[model samples]
Target: MKLLHTSLAALALAGFAGAALAQDPTEIRIQWYSDGIEGEVMQDLLDRFEEENPDIDVVLDNVAYQVIQEQLPIQLASGRGPDIARVTNLKEQAQHWLDLRPYLSDEQVAYWEENFGNRFDWMREDGSDAIPGFLTQLTMVGGFANATLFEQAGVEMPGDGATWDEWVEAAAQVMESQGTAAAFAIDRSGHRISGPNASFGANYIAEDGSPAPIDDGTMEFVTKLVNWTNEGLQLPDVWVSAAGTTYRSGADDFINAQIPLLYSGSWQVANLSTTIGDAFDWVAIGSPCGPAGCSGLAGGAALVAIEYTEHPEEVARVMDWLASEKIVREFSERTLFLPAHAGIVEEGGLEFQSDDPNVPPALDRFVQASGETLPLADQLPAWRWANAYYGALVTRISQAMAGEITLDQARELMDQDIADVVANANQ
Candidate 1:
C-alpha cells in the first residue's frame, strides 16, 4: 500500500510538470529596417506589446534596408526566419511567403477595405489565397524649393498645377537670373526617380507579372532627362560623376540656397524643418507632371509574417497593433510619414508641419498625386536581382546623360540585361 501511494505521488508530480511546460510563454522574432527614429519608435511599441502580453517574448532583429532583402530568403529556407518581417514590395512577399488570408478574418478585411480604400491590393498576390501584410505609412509628394534663391532672383514660385515643360522653363529662368543656384536637382538613381518616372507614365515593368519593354513613353522620358542635363538645368557633376551627394545633399543645397528646387519624398519634411529652421524660408511644391496629369509612385514598407513562424497568431496580433490607430498616429508624429490609416489622417490631428507654412499645401498636392492613376512595379522574384537591375539601369542612364552613349544604345543594353536576368532567374 505504501508502494502504491509513492507511485501515485510520482504520477501527480509528472502531470504538474507537463502542465507547467505547456503554459510556457511563446517567443516571437521580428525583423525590420530602421532609419534611426522609426527604429526607436518601433522598439518602444514592441516594449508596450511585451508588457501587455507577458506570455509572449518579442525579439527584434534590426537590419539595414538593403541587407534585409538579401538575408530574408536564405534565412527562411534555412528554417530560421523571423515570425514577422517588414517587406517593401508585394512581389517579394507573394513569391516567397505564406498566404496571410487565413489569419485575417472577413470582418477585419471589411474594416481595412472600408477605411483604406483598395490600395491594399498591392499587398495581395494574383492567385494566392493570402493578404501578405499591412502598410503603416506612405511617402507623400512634396518638393523643396529655395525661397531665398527665388526671392533673390525675383522669380515667382511655380504654380501647383505646373507641367514638366513649365517647370523646366521656370527652373532655367531661375538659374539664369540667380546665377548662384542650380536650376533643378534630383537623385537620379534607384527608386528616387520613380516619382518623376511615374509622372511621365514610364514604368519598369507591367501589371500582369511580366516584363514590359520600355515604350515610347520611356524614350520621351530619357530624351527629356538628357536634354535637361545638357541644357545646364542640372547642377554640374550631379549625374555625371559618382559623388557623396545623396538626396539629403540635394536638400542641403536647397536649404543653403545653392539649388532652387529639390525633389524628394515627404518623409524629409521634419528633417528639413529641423535642419534649416528659420535659416531661410523654404516652400514645398507639388512635382510637375507629364501630359498624363500629376502622379507619383507609392513608396513605403509593409509588415509581413514568415511562413515558418511558430507563433503566427502572435505575429498577427503584433501587426494588428502596429496597424492600430494609436500606434500609427504615434509613428506618424514621430517619423513625419503620412499615416496609412485613413481614419488617423482624418481624426488624428496630425499636424504635418509646425515650422514650414508651405507644408499643408504640399501635402494637399501629394493627395492630388495619389488620386491620379499610378503604375505599380511588378515584384521581382529575388530582391537582389531587382537591386542589380536598378543599379545597372542608373549607371547606364547616367553614362548616356554624360554623352558616353546614345539613348538607343542604352535601351538595347537595358533589354539585354533584363533578358539575362530573366533567364538566370528562371534557371
Candidate 2:
C-alpha cells in the first residue's frame, strides 16, 4: 500500500510539471533596425499583439542598421539568426528567407498574395513562387532643395521639367548667393546615382540576367558628375571623403545648410522633418530630367522570416498580425513611410502624421516621381545583379572623383568588376 501511494504521488507531480510546461508561451525573437519613429511604433503594436495572443511572446531585438547590412548575412548563411529580420538587401540574401505559405492559413495566404504579391519577386530568387516576405516601406530616390536658400539667394528653383544641368546651375547660383560650402551633394552610393544614370538612358542589365558593360549613357552622367566635382560645383566631401564603396550621405551637409540641394530618397522624410524643424524650408524636387527622361530607382526594406527559425508558426502569426491592412495603414500614417501594400495604396487617404508643413508635399512628390521611373530603372530593384553593378560603380567612380583614375579607367574597371561578380556568383 505504501509503495502504491508513492507511485501515485510521483504520477501527480509529473502531470503538474507537464501542465506548467504547456502553459509557457513560445518565444520568438525579431531582429529589427530603425531609421526613424517606426521602431517605437512597431513595439506599441507588438504590445497589443501580445495581449490578444497569450500563447506567443515576441521579443524585439533592436540593432544598428550596419548589423543588418553586414553581420546578419553572415549569421543567416550559417543557418543561425533571429527568427525574423528587417533587411534592405533583399534580393542578394533572399535564399535564407522562410516561406510562410505552408504555415499560414489559406485565407492569410490569399490576403498576402493580393496585397504584397507584386513585390515578392524583389525579395525572392528568380523563378521562385515562395511567399518569403513583404516590403515594410517603398522608397523612391529623388532630390530635395532648400527652398529657403533658393528664395534667399533669389535663385529660382528649377521647374517641373528642368534638366539635371539646369538644376545644378540653379543650385550653384544659390551656393554663390548663400555663401554655402558647396552647391549640392549626392549620397556617396552607387544606388544613389543609378537613378540619375537611368535618367541619362543608361541600362545596366544585359539581355540575360548578368550585368551589362558600362555604356555611353552611364558615362554621360558620370563624366558630368566627375567634372562637376572637379569644378567645385558638387560637394567634394561626399564622394571624395569615402573610399572603396563605403556608404556616405551628404544629408548632414544639406540639413546644416552647407549645401543648397541634396539627392537622396523618400526614407529621409521623417529624419529631415525632425532634424531640420523650422530651421529652414525644404521641398522634394522629384528627380531632375536628363536627355532620356526624369527617373528614380524604386526599392525598400522588407520584414522577412529567416528559414532557420525554430517557431515558424509563431513567426507567421506575428508577421500576419503586423501585415494586416489596418496595421499597415496605421504604421504608414504614423511613420510617414510610403505604403507598399497595394490595397492600402489604392484605398488612398494616408494622412501622414507630421506637424511639419514640408512632410506631406515631399511624400506626394515622391509618389508622383515613382510613376516617372524609366523601365530600366524599375527593373533594377528586383534584379539580383543590381548590387554588383552598383558596388562597382561607386568604387570606380569614387576613384575617378578622387583623381586616382581617369574617367575611362573608371569605366573599364567597372566593367571588369561586374564581370568578376558574375563569374563568382555562377561558381
Candidate 3:
C-alpha cells in the first residue's frame, strides 16, 4: 500500500510538469523603430497575430532610430540581439539576417518571392539568394514647399523642370519677402544628398565594384550647398548645428513656417500631415533638376529576421503574418506609407486613411517622381559600400559646413574614408 501511494504521487507530479510545459508559449522579441504612426499600427496587428497563434508570444521593443543605426550592429556582431528588427541599413548588415526559405512553406515562400523579390537584392548578400526580409515602405527622396508661405510672399512656387538653383532663388525671394529665417534646408544626411549628387552626374560605384573618387558632379552641388549656407540663403542650422553624422531634419523648420522649402523624402507625408494640419498648405515639388536630370534616391525600411534568433519558426510566423497581402494593404493604408508589396502596389487603389486633401496629392507626386530616379541613384540602395560612402559624405560635408574644412579638403577626406572602409572589409 505504501509503495502504491508513492508511485501514484510521482506520476501525478510528472503529469503536472508536462501540462505546465505545454502551456508555456514561445516568446519572440521584435526590435522596432518608427518614423511615424506605423509603430502603433504594428502593435495592433501583432495583438491580432497573438490571439490567433496562442502558442507564440510577440514582444515588441520600440526603440529609437539611432539604436537601429548604431547599437544594433554591435549587438548583432556579439550574437546577441532581438529576434527580428526593422532597419533601413539593410544591405550592409545582410549577413546577420535569417534565410526563411527552409522554414516557410513552399507556397508561402513563393508568395514572398513574388511580392517582395524586387528588393531582396537590396537586403541580401551579393550573389546569394537568401530571403532575408521585405521592405515595409518604398521611400523616394523629394522636395516639399510651404505653398502658403510662397503665396503670402507673392512668389510662385517653382514648377516642373525647374532647376535646384531656380527653386533656391524662388525660396530666397519668399524668405526675403516674408522675413523667414532662410530659403530652404535639406535633411542632414549623406543619403539625402546622394540624389542631388546623382542629378549632377556623380557616380559612386567604380568599374571594379569599388568606391569611386569624388567627381565634378558631386562638387557642383556640394559647392552650391556650401555657398548657399554661407550666404544665408540656405538654412545653416540643420547641417551645421549637429556635429559628426547625427541626423537633423529641416521638417521642423518647414513645419514651424520658418522656411519655405523642405528637401526631405516621402516618408514625411504621414508626419507632415499629422503635425501641419490646417496651419498651412504644402506640396510635394518632386526633385529639383540639375545638369544631369532631376533625381531622387530610392530606399526604405525592411523588417528582417535575425540569424541569431532561437525562435526562427515563431519569427517566421510573425513575419508571414505581417507580410501578408491583407496586412500589407492595411498597414500601408493606416500609416499612409507607400506599399512595398508588389501585389498591393500593382493592384493599386489604396484609400489612405486620411481626410487631409494634401495627403493624396503628395503621395501621388512621390509615386510619379519615383519614376524619375536617376540610374546611379537607383543602384546606390543595394551597393554594399553605399553606407560607407554615405557616412563619409555626411562626416566630411558637415565639417565643411561648419567651417572646419574646405570643400576640397572634405572631398579628399571622403575618398580616403571610403577607401579605408573597403580595405578593412576585405582584410
Candidate 4:
C-alpha cells in the first residue's frame, strides 16, 4: 500500500509537469504602428504564425509613432522593451538590435541573405556582417495626382519629364478652375521634402559623409518652395504651420479632394484604394525633375528584434516566419507595400492587387527607380548618427521655409545641430 501511494504521487507530479510545459509558450510582443490597413493585415499573418507554431504567441501592441521614437530607446536601454518592433530609425537604433545569427539555422539565415541581404546589411554595425532585421516596406517617395480634378477643370496633366515647376503650374490651373483650396500639398516630413530635393541633386549629406544640408541643387528646390508658399501655390498649414520635426500629415487634404496634387508615396496605395474607392480618379506619376534628374527618395521601416529579449530563439522563429518569401509576398501584396525581397521582386515582380493602373506601374517603377536618387550609402546610412543628421536637416530646413532663417543660415544651424548630437553621443 505504501509503494502504491508513492507511485500514484509520482504520476500526478509528472502530469503536472507535462501540463506546465504545454502552457509555457514563447510570447513575442511586436510594437507596431500603421499608416493605413497594414496593422490589420499584419495581425492576420501573425495569427497564422501562432496557429502553425502553437508554442509561440505573438502580441501586437499598436502604439503611436511617438512611443517608438521617444520611449523605446529608454526601454531598450533598461532591457524592458518589446521582443520585436517595427521601426524607421534602423540606423539610429542598430546598437540595441539582436544579431539573429545564432538563433536562425544555417539554411534559414541563407534564405534571409538571399531575399533581403542589402536591407539586412542596412541594420548591421558598420564594417560588421550582421542581420538584425528586414524591411516591412521598401518605400520610394513620390506623388499622387487628382486626375479627376484636372479633367474637370480642363487642365492638362503633365506626363514624363515634367519639371516640379510645370507640375505646380498644372496643379495651380486645376485648383483655380475647380476652386480647390490648394494647388499642392505634401506630408510635412523631412523624408517627404528630401525626396523632391533629390531630383534637384541635393545630397543633404556631403560626399565625405558629413552634414551638408544645402547646395545650389538643393537651393533650387528650397527657393521654388519658398516662392510657392508666397504665391499660394503650396499650402502653408501643412508644412510651415508646424515647427521642428513634428509631422503634419496631408493625407486628409489629398483624400478629401481639396488638394489638386499630393506629394506622397506607395504606402498610401492601400488607403487610397479602399477609402477613396470610385470617389476620385487619381494616379501615381513619375517623380518630378529639376536640373539633376527626375528621381525620388527610397526608404522604409523595419521589423527588428530587441537585443535584450530573453527569448532570442523565439524571436528568430517569429522573424524567420515573417521574413519568409511566401509570407513577405502576402504581406506586401495585401498591404500594397513595395517589398525588398530580391527573388520575389525578380521572379514575377510584386504581384500587387490594385485596379488603378498607376498603382501597380508606380510600384514597378519605384522598385526599378533605385539608383535614380543619389545613394545615401557611403557613410550617412551606415553610421549611427543618421537620425541626428536627418533631424537637424528637417528642423532647420523647416525654419528656413517658414522665413525664420535664410537657407544658408539654416544650413549653418543644421551643421551645428549634427555636430552637437554627434559630440554628445561620443561622450
**Each candidate structure's count of clashing pairs:** 0, 0, 0, 0
Candidate 3 structure quality by residue, lDDT tens digits, 142-180 = 999999999999999889899999999999999999999
> Which digits, one per residue and each the tens of the lDDT, describe model 4 over residues 1-427?
9999999999999999999887978888999989888899999999999999999999999998898888998998887899999988787678899999889889988988888887765687777678798999888777889889999999999987799999999999999999988899877776676666767877766566556645666667877887787688887878788888887877788889989898877777778777788888888875787777877777788999999898999999999999988999999988889888888878866677777665676666566555466554223345566677567766876687688998788767877888898678779
Off by over 4 Å in 4: 1-17, 354-358, 376-385
* All models, RMSD in angstroms: 4.8, 2.7, 2.8, 2.6
Clash list (residue pairs), candidate 1: none
Against the unseen true structure, what C-alpha lDDT does each candidate score?
Answer: 0.67, 0.93, 0.94, 0.81
Compute each candidate's TM-score over C-alphas.
0.81, 0.96, 0.95, 0.92
Candidate 2's residue-wise lDDT over 1-427, tens digit each? 9999999999999999989878979998989999898999989999999999988998999999999999999999899999999999999999999999998899999999999999999999999988888899999999999999999999999889899999999999999998999899999999999999999989898898678889999999999999999999999999987878789989999999999999999999999999999999999999999999999899999999999999998999999999999999999999999999999999999989999999999999999998999998889989999899899999999899899999999999999999998899899
Error of 4 at 234 (Å): 0.9
Model 4 TM: 0.92
| Weakest ten-residue segment in model 2 by summed lDDT | 203-212
Candidate 2 lDDT at 20 equals: 85
